[model samples]
Target: MIEMIEIAPKVLGLRINGKINEEDMEKMLSVCKAKMKDEERIAVYVEVEEIGGISFNALIEDLKFALPNLKRFSKKAVVSDIKWHEPLIKVGDKLFPSIEVRHYNQDQRAEALKWVQE
Candidate 1:
């Protein structure tokens, strides 16, 4: 499941769990684009609590569409218990230097929010 909330004017709080597929990817992208339409700067707090897994094609499509938006966001905080996500986010940081991607433990949700708000 994927859920999103607008925490601030240009900040979005997103949570993802369970198995993500192509349909979920499409919905997520639509939500993000709609939220960011009039905002020049955005911040995202992405929480991955129990992601069963993601489809390979869906993951690729997500990256293709979302990576460019990272440059438009001021900061992005990814909270996850998944080990592989850290390195993946680090790579994303390199790809979009304008946006800061910080990974946090699942328990550190509040801290992640604070970091992005900073």
Candidate 2:
């Protein structure tokens, strides 16, 4: 499941658990775009504690839609226990100069939030 909430004028909080499908990716893209339309400097806090995995097609679509927006965002924080996600996130950080993706333990959510807010 994907849950998204606007925490601040320029910040969005996201929680994802379970497999992500194309529909979910599309929804997330729409939400992000809508929020970014109002705020140029978007920040995202994503928690993926229960996310089992993401489909290959969904991942591709997500990247296609999100990459451009990442450049417009100020920061992005990804909180995940999954180890394999680190490399992908690193690549994303490299691709998006405006965004910084930091992997944090679930317990370090506060620190992660602070880093992104900085």
TM-score of each: 0.80, 0.79
Residue by residue across 85-115, what tens digits does model 1's lDDT show?
A: 9999999899888888899997898898888
Number of colliding residue pairs in model 1: 0
Off by over 4 Å in 2: none
Candidate 1 has a TM-score of 0.80
Off by over 4 Å in 1: none
Record all residue pairs in model 1 with backbone atoms less than 3 Å apart, i.e. clashing.
none
Write down the RMSD of all candidates, one decimal each.
2.2, 2.2
Give model 2's clash tally. Answer: 0
lDDT of each: 0.83, 0.81
